[model samples]
Target: MNEKLHCIGCGTEIQTENPQEPGYAPVSSLEKEDIICKRCFRLKNYNELQPVSLTDDDFLRILNGLGTQKGLIVKIVDIFDFNGSWLPGLHRFVGSNPVLLIANKVDLLPKSVNKNKVINWIKQEAKNLGLKPIDVLLVSAHKGSGMTEAMEAIEHYRRGEDVYVVGCTNVGKSTFINRIIKTATGTGDIITTSHFPGTTLDMIEIPLDDKKAIFDTPGIINHHQMAHYLDPSELKFIMPKKEIKPKTFQLNAGQTLFVGALARFDFIQGQRAAFTVHIANDLDIHRTKLEKADELYANHRGELLAPPSEKYIDQLPRLVRHEFSIKEAKTDIVFSGLGWITIQDTNCVIAAYAPEGVEVQVRPSLI
Candidate 1:
């Protein structure tokens, strides 16, 4: 009989068979006296991320236990994909605990974006989702910006209680925790950080003081996110690694824009106006006549218009149209996990298309 071993970082039972799943360690590493899994090793050494899966029931079960614990819930959200990153029924899991909302990835937005306006929008969106955050702090876990403010807020609100850091996958929760740990303890040691969902299978705790600790929980997987549909290689083209340089396109009433093969936007009845796009700076954007849009897509889906390459075409949901009639102010047509288009034409009608389950929303412009 063989003795079972577990990862010291996330506590998942270690195995060597699958590299894509959690608790994976190489055969050599598994023989060591003290070992961290390969996922945690990569995160600690290279700051890289990987994805893993967890059932909805497992996620709910972990969160449901939080209600019975006494702590401050620090819910991290990706500013770019708020709706897609939000964990549904989060309010039910926290009981009466106060939530400190930290909006991560502020560095990805353009410099012209107003922080105050963005914060206000985040508050409104969270409220609409039935989450009443005690304080909302915007920070970039990657750049180490606005983290001091987040720490101050956590110190003030936590008030000697244990803190549970929670969020959906890919929201930068693990990176944020690693930053906090490095800042507090003056150590480069990091908890596992991965782009994949379910990176943390069990709670990994770091002592905040002699009496209290901060626990990093596993990220709840959101199936609607494009991250779940796209391959790891394809994600680099969609997910922004650096600040986005907004691409402005002047389009007529009959023009259409294609964002790789992941999404499309049509100027149905809008005036000749500029539509500013905010997406990964590296993604290719193409413009064509609206009449030829369907034909172009049909011909070049996995070729000229890529991302849903030949291998992923069958897995991707069919594009569904969401018609919007802009009324007063500037509005953003958001395609979840991809990017958004900001338009300023009043009484203008536009149509945004994305995968069927992925959310396409209209909100007041952030810029």
Candidate 2:
């Protein structure tokens, strides 16, 4: 029998079949001195990320081991998808280690958005979620923004101990580590990065000093994210690449807005109000009468209202409604991972709808 080979990059056991699966390398590449899976190859050369599915058992095992390890836990979360990317109850798993929360993708927010306010919002959310980090800082790993401050903060907090970077899949943990590598050794893109989730399969350790190193752990998949239900091609529509240009729609009661057939916002019984949508600028949001919503979705889900685009409409889950009463003057209805709709008017009754498994909730505005 042939001895099993593994990808030098992601550490997945190599296989020649099924390009979609983890650890798939081309048959021709088998004889090469250094072999990497096809997924890592595309990520390195093209800067494209391919999606992979790993069992929950695999991620839980890694997370369960964090408490036993003596290191600083540097947790990264997507600023845009704050709640969706959060690893709930992580404070318990870290034991006595201090956590430094690094919020990635800050560049995606509008320039008008206040940085201090965002940081304060994150700190509050972290406390509410049972994580009391040593510090909360924002960074954009893709744009190389705030990396210097992040590095300084990490070094200061780690105190000669090792660092473990953890976050859910697609939170840019790999890209952030790549930035650290480039800054430290001038190496370019050592870890594979893509827009899709589950890019890293194993814990990759980078030496911080002779005695300590930073470990990039596999991203624990957040099952509640909207990204799981859509096809790879459709991800571009939801994942914002540029600063979000807040889109505000003036609507009266009984109006329905569709966020690419992935989420729905209805002004059920509200006075005239302006709902500012903070989503990927490229995503289409169509407004129609509430009475016509059912007919319109039934007719146009895969077409006019997309991203369960015609290709994957059948696989998409049914929309589940979660209604909220707007008590605060400035409130956000978050459609976890997709984006949010901020309603600045009080005493309004509204309903947010998202795919059955996807999460939708109300919170104070981030901006």
Worst 10 residues of 1 by lDDT: 190-199
Reference-based TM-score, model 2? 0.89
Tens-digit lDDT track of model 1 for 73-185? 99999988888898878998899999999999999999989899999998998899999999999999999999999998998999899888888888988789778877765
Best by TM-score: 1
lDDT of 2 by residue, 122-241 (tens): 898899889898999999999999999999998999998988888888899868977786676454354432121233365555667655877767667888777778787888889999
Q: Which runs of model 1 end up more than 4 angstroms from their true locations?
A: 1-11, 31-36, 39-53, 188-200
In lDDT terms, which candidate is top?
1
Model 1 clash number? 4
Per-candidate TM equals: 0.90, 0.89
In terms of lDDT, model 1 sits at: 0.83
